[model samples]
Target: MTRPELKTDPKYDDYDYPTTAPEVQSGHPGHTTPEQDAQVFQLRTQLEQAGYKERLDTLCMLRFLRARKFNVDLAKQMFIDCEKWRKEFGVDDLVRNFDYKEKPQVFEYYTQYYHKTDKDGRPVYIEQLGKIDLAAMYKITTGERMLQNLVVEYEKLADPRLPACSRKSGQLLETCCTIMDLKGVGITKVSSVYGYVKQASAISQNYYPERLGKFYLINAPWGFSSVFGVVKGFLDPVTVQKIHVLGSNYQTELDKQVPKENLPKIFGGTCDCKGGCALSDEGPWQDPEWKKPPKWEQPSKTSQPTTTTTAPAPQAASNAGTQAEIKGAQQAPMGS
Candidate 1:
């Protein structure tokens, strides 16, 4: 398909797109035109003038701009709200201090993790919704703890994971490829956990915009059609377009984007790690050749933990793409 025209300047028209994967276009990182760069600059200037101290990185400003469709005003408001929420939520403190000792138990009931890279070199994040046991999960952790974990994972995703993937693939990686397995999920189970899902979705969309790369709702039951139809109403068109809703026959399509060697065996791929792919935390970020400690790592504390799962006692957590919003479907949130 011909790319839509992007206003460009002779100086910035040489922006490179990845050769190994499909070209990332206008709305994402690594593909900005002159106008987009100006927009980011304007946003940065406004934020700085407004007294915002951090999160003014060019990539981040671009993300917020893309999320708001490049509307500087709306992007500014969103950025302001996100910063306020960050402080109120104590995100910086949680990233450094919060630990989820019950991570092992939590994973047993609700599986979420980064296993490996997709064919395009973006990290593959997998979640199993059909297996959720909210009651059991809550026994070991509260909803607040889960939110903290989500924030922590988002931070890790932005750092070690994406940077490592970018270095390994020789490209700039900004989003994630998500696979949400829904084999046994039914309305009753969904209803029981809707509240938590809503809260989670809000945090992801409101705080972490533009992180979805590819989304696959695999093993989707027949009943999910109506549910998804309703869910679709709540998501943006760009996000809805990125989602692939599939039933049991998801293997063929999944294999096209994620290599069988990299995919977990349970998902119709050849991979089955020593423990389990859900908890493996395997990816380019873990490769000694490319891996580096996250900037957030503290000298005194060696191990890093995340919301979905924690690092081993002696270790730290490691760290995708799409223009998709990841809203309403990809994340465990009943809704972003």
Candidate 2:
């Protein structure tokens, strides 16, 4: 049998496809803006001078800069503060060595999980806030351990999760699709967990800027929207825009962005993976059968020092290529 001819569109004949994981692209101001590029360069130079060259990458630096709206001094201070926190929290040691043996037990009381991919191919992170029982959770794990687990998950997201999603989608995916379920939450419950929630939110927003692509507050209780209206006044407009507060009738809207098969049965879908959906970690990134080819070329060890700062380490570079290839194959037509 003869294979069909591969067709090309003239419109995209001049399109320069991304060859690297975080290569600059249109529409993503955080990655492409001239000011951001300058800031990234400046930040890297400063980090190297401060002997923190090995501690962070351009992407991490950009996150801090974006968090501070590209204010050099503010971004530097934020980076320094994060470094201090990392030492105090032992985040590096946690990432390399810490193990959460109580993950299963803790999840039973507080459902926080990365289930599957949304329509845009971003990982879907769901947190059933109403299900959280601090008393029960603390029996298995302390708040400190929970925060450590959260940090580990965030590190994994930066390494394998987003990279894998980006590879599968044939584009850079630095953010996640989030669903915060507040079905049984009341004022009393909210007050009970206010401190923990506030701390977690601070860590995510201040330290991991641009990590939230889409946020859905589903199963919103009565008066929650009005409360959010007041709370949003203190949030960045860009952050507020990504959040959608939905009532019980959120299935229709959720279905538009997430396939029924990908979503869990509890969340108005049919997926019931073995063990449980909350712990399944099911997604394209976890598919062993879908192997991604290496698409990014490794930079030479002796490349110009200026360019070297932009390139990630050898392992990271390899992972980026692997991820992009996986996403490209999964999402795009063969020989397109």
The candidate maximizing TM-score is 1
lDDT of 1 by residue, 1-336 (tens): 654333333422332333222366775654677788789879887776676656676667888898878888888877877776877787777777878778779988888888889998888988888878889888899988887888888878877788788788887677889999888898898788777777776677777877788889898888776877877776667677778999999988999999999999888889889877777789999999988777667443211121223211321101111222335337643112
Q: Which candidate is the best by lDDT?
A: 1
Off by over 4 Å in 2: 1-31, 289-336
Q: Which stretches of candidate 1 lie over 4 Å from their true place?
A: 1-24, 226-234, 298-329, 333-336
Candidate 1 at 304: error in angstroms? 25
lDDT of 2 by residue, 1-336 (tens): 432211222321221222233434432433345665676778766765655634345556666766666776677666766665666776666777778888888877677788778888788888776777888888888888877777777776665566667667766577778887788877887777766665665556434555767778899888888977877766666666777889999999999888899899988999999999987887766865432322222221211223233422221111122223222211111000
Say what the RMSD of model 2 is: 11.1
For model 2, what is the error of residue 23's alpha carbon versus the real structure, in angstroms, after optimal superposition? 12
Cα error of candidate 2 at position 297, Å: 21
Please report the TM-score between candidate 2 and the true structure. 0.77
Q: lDDT per model, in order?
A: 0.73, 0.63
